[model samples]
Target: MPVAPKRMPFFEHIAELRKRLIVVVVTVVVLALGLYTWGWQIFDFVLRPVQSALELAGAEKLNILGPFATFTLRFKVATYAAIVVASPIIIWQVMAFFLPALKPKEQRYVVPTFGTMVALFIGGIAFCYIVVAPTAFEWMVAQAGGNSVQVLPDAALWFQAVLLLLFAFGLGFQLPVIVFYLMIFNIVPYNKLRANWRYAYVIIVTTAAIATPDWSPVTMGALAAALIVLYEGSMLLARIVLSRRIGEQKRREAIMAAGGDPDEIDALDA
Candidate 1:
């Protein structure tokens, strides 16, 4: 008689998941505390661009909002910073959860995917903080030049808007990485996507327009143009990848066609 295979307890899987969750929670909390200690400095750094914009536009000092607003704002900034700092750990935890189910080749894709996600997010944040935020603020300030519009930036509103824009751009900048990965996975065919390029441009421009809160046509056009360029760049990359794969496939078929014998150089009898 064949012996029955032993079954592992279901709780073992649950325990493993629980352990990862605990690690992520503890790491985030510790980082949050560390960030809180330096929260004021971090907040100041984030606000510097806006501060400079206001100064350049000859606006007066930013009038902060109600009591306890400073403390709350610092806490929010620290929390966001901690989240950013702990992203790798969080990503690892998420990837680990699916580790058992992935094949070897699929497993190889994980680290690169994680890295790409992180890089894209950082790029997006930088784009927002460095390019989009400053330009948009300058434009907004320029709009108020003729009128005696005193800019009293509410601490809460300013920070909120800054965070929103930063995150929006950062997430937006992931387009190329996302599309390339989709192509790699064969989720979307290259020819099909290429054929729909016109529609894609329209959608990309629309997305950029929606993402731009201030509704400046120039800013929207800039962001959309950037995204479209990235889209084309991704397509070029995907083409190289697909071409390589096709060449390998053709070589394999050639070998197979040669009667499964590399030495065979002439037509064989059936």
Candidate 2:
């Protein structure tokens, strides 16, 4: 059999990355144009749930800021839509381009990792839209105490805040996958992570508290608690992966100690 060649040089990898990035950028732009064409309808769809909630709460009106706020809002929604649409393709391109450099076993993990990432990202955004945003909006509105202050919702700012929050939550949810990879590479041992759990818990809570825009203790405290739960969940997953790796390592050692080829042990067991 022909031997596989060594990986490409750093410059070659960079050039490939540049090419892939261009493709992703073009795809996003095309999708954005489509979204812009139907921007108003999409905007209405996005805001419909919040609008209902506001109306139910007896809010007189949802006001937009500045003459251009409407346009900016539509464009912002369209851009975010573009990102949502292009994410899978972008991830696919990246995975395909980088596959040659990864080990066969590691490559097997890619599809599931991508899927988990996509699901987590969508889940985070949905959670923000469904739970956090509405709750925050309601609290803020109630706090206004029927004052005549024009609660003009800036379209651009609203989406910007939502997008950032969504991204933060999504990235936060990737903690498990990250730690699993770290364990796989022996960069962070399971025992070390477990030993530092207390510190990690503190950091997670602090980060969650800071990530929320609301200054209220209620929101910050809730976010912090949620972060702690997620941290523990990630640790649980890391432990599972670490256990599997340890089991494989032991099996290999057993075969070696028995004066048998590790690969042949599988056939013998069969």
Candidate 3:
């Protein structure tokens, strides 16, 4: 038997949140410290795609304008890497803080949904790095007129741009998971999403345009296309889940009407 979660007073809740936040901060800082030791290697890895793009355009390497620029860039890179590395702990802390407030059925969905979100986030980042970054950078390089203009990008700006794009794509890929929960909780109907797909497409395109770091149409279009697919796929899955839930509800209703316990019916069915 599962033990019921204990409810805390408002002040206690605040204290608990503070504790979790402290844990999350400590974890991230520790991870950051570890990453700082290898910050140069990580920076080089992050710079690889841009370097390739620059090479393809026969451009020079990125420039560091200030004395502290490299140090600052490495620190920033380590921080970003730390956040990525500590994401699971951060998420767990967040979930633990809020899980007590959710109903049992809602709680059941949390773990699976969180897992899906993490997988989608990683997939999105991978897509941005492997496909979007290279394509966008190549396009930007091409616009510089093939060695006519010096293509010396600022290292700091380049890192910021890549990190922003990666974060955007990772968060953007959570659309399906968000949609799934909305449908599961009956906050949004699957039919409604299906009906409003045109509006959804506009929203997706606008979001992709806004989220992408560069103004390259190829990158925006790719993100939009991927989001649309995820949205449609989510809708389809939501429909199936909704159908099964409705069927189960109807079956329970029929069982109750026939003077049979729904629990026993479920047990028998199982």
Candidate 4:
């Protein structure tokens, strides 16, 4: 007779975690190298918004400041790009590492959630690249003391601001996943979440204020709005995904409320 496989011991679990971490690290590092080789092209795309805003403000190019600025900027860009590109694999490895602890039903949800998370992160970055960065840079340029001041920002700082905002938006885009999982685990119930919109809005605004590196009103407001929409969207998705589970819970509650047979309802709940 074939033997059934036993669960991993504590040390084995630790080893598996270490292995997953290693894979994530190696994937990012390898991707970084490849992206570094194509750094300039990446720049042309990622930096387009800032560059356009600068050009419009009469600055032909960014200030290069010091000898190693270009090298350092390219290196940072490549590393960030690698993280952005390798996000799907990284999220998968991280989620897969914890799969053994989940119930079968829970495990089934993880795969689809993984893809949703990747999409959210990428969407955030793209939104920043295409909209947030461009708008913020243009507004900043316009505020730079009028025509007397040229808007030739330091290359390193420019890249830093742009990258920071991109990452901020990317993470912001994952609000739905966070909300959905909170519901899934009953850490926060669906009805409570829906009922407490004011508090949630406060938290979202505060999170946006902190997460956005610029601390600009524009970026913060944009992220907060996007997150609010995502939060509401998550509620809709949860209702659909957990439709049957939620329906059963409602039925049990109704029986309890109506003073029906508690024993049978309790048995089914358990």
Please identify model 1 stretches exceeding 4 Å from their true place: 1-21, 56-60, 99-101, 145-149, 259-270
Better model by TM-score: candidate 2 vs candidate 4? 4
Badly placed stretches (over 4 Å) of model 4 are 1-6, 147-150, 248-270
Per-model lDDT = 0.76, 0.69, 0.83, 0.83
lDDT of 1 by residue, 1-270 (tens): 111123336787677678888888889888888899898788778877687667866656555677887788888889888888887788778777766666555666677877877887888788778877887777776777757676666766777777777766777777897788788779988898999999989999989888877677656776788789889989999899889878766766787777677444222211
Pairs in steric clash, model 4: none
What RMSD does each model have against the real structure?
6.6, 4.1, 2.7, 5.0
Error of 1 at 183 (Å): 1.8
The alpha-carbon deviation from the true structure for residue 100 of candidate 1, after best TM-score superposition, in angstroms, is 4.5
lDDT for each residue of candidate 3 in 1-270, tens digit (9 for 90 to 100): 122246889898888888888888998898888899899899888877667787876656677898998888888889999998887777767777888888766787777876887888899999988888887887877888855576677788888888888888998998898888788888987778788989989999999999887857988998999999999899889889889888877887788889997577775345
| Global fold similarity of model 2 (TM-score) | 0.82
- Backbone clash pairs for candidate 2 read none
Candidate order by TM-score, highest to lowest? 3, 4, 2, 1
* lDDT, residue 106, candidate 2: 68
Worst 10 residues of 3 by lDDT: 1-10
Model 1: weakest 10-residue lDDT segment is: 1-10
> How many clashing residue pairs appear in each of the predictions shown?
1, 0, 0, 0
Candidate 1 — number of clashing residue pairs? 1
